[model samples]
Target: MPRMNDVGGQDGFGPVIEELDEPPFHADWEAHVMAMNRALIGQGVYNLDEFRDAVERTMSHESSYYENWFRAIQTLLKERGVV
Candidate 1:
């Protein structure tokens, strides 16, 4: 086996790094993404440069965060009837 490049994996995020791209969104999911983005901001997850740095960090690592993050997001969405 060999070492893989840092930004080369399923969650590596590739060139599609920015969180929002337009086409796949339905109106609600668009709102959902924006709301999530806001919540992240409100929570002080990062300042401008730091957010990108944090995302870049995650982009290079293998992420199991989706398992937990999605469940939490979906649970909220379901409770909110956005699911």
Candidate 2:
């Protein structure tokens, strides 16, 4: 089954708005989360597939992109006894 984050063909979610000249991040914490994800992956704490799986598993329809990522990181770390 498709996960909540998999909103490919399903509708009712509305259109995705493209922000002109959008910044890479909306908040410092979002950037930190991205950096942490990179660091953890670089250290071989978990591979990309593992991280993606965690993200998909923990994601909700209401979460923003970075919020989902942050939750995924936490979930993965906790499952691996790293947190």
State the weakest 10-residue window (summed lDDT) of model 1. 1-10
> Which runs of model 1 end up more than 4 angstroms from their true locations?
1-31, 42-45, 60-83
Per-candidate Cα lDDT values, in order, are 0.47, 0.93
Count clashing residue pairs in model 2. Answer: 0
Give candidate 2's error at residue 22 in angstroms: 0.9
Candidate 2 global lDDT: 0.93
For candidate 2, lDDT tens digit of each residue in 1-83? Answer: 87777877887988788999999999999999999999999999999999999989899879999999999999999999999
Candidate 1 per-residue C-alpha lDDT over 1-83 given as tens digits, one digit per residue, 9 for 90 to 100:
32232434446355645666646554565556556756855776534454443444334245333333334444444544745
Top TM-score model: 2
Residue 9, candidate 1: C-alpha displacement in angstroms = 18
Pairs that collide, model 2: none
**Which 10 consecutive residues of model 2 have the lowest summed lDDT?**
2-11
Q: Supply candidate 2's per-residue lDDT for 67.
A: 95
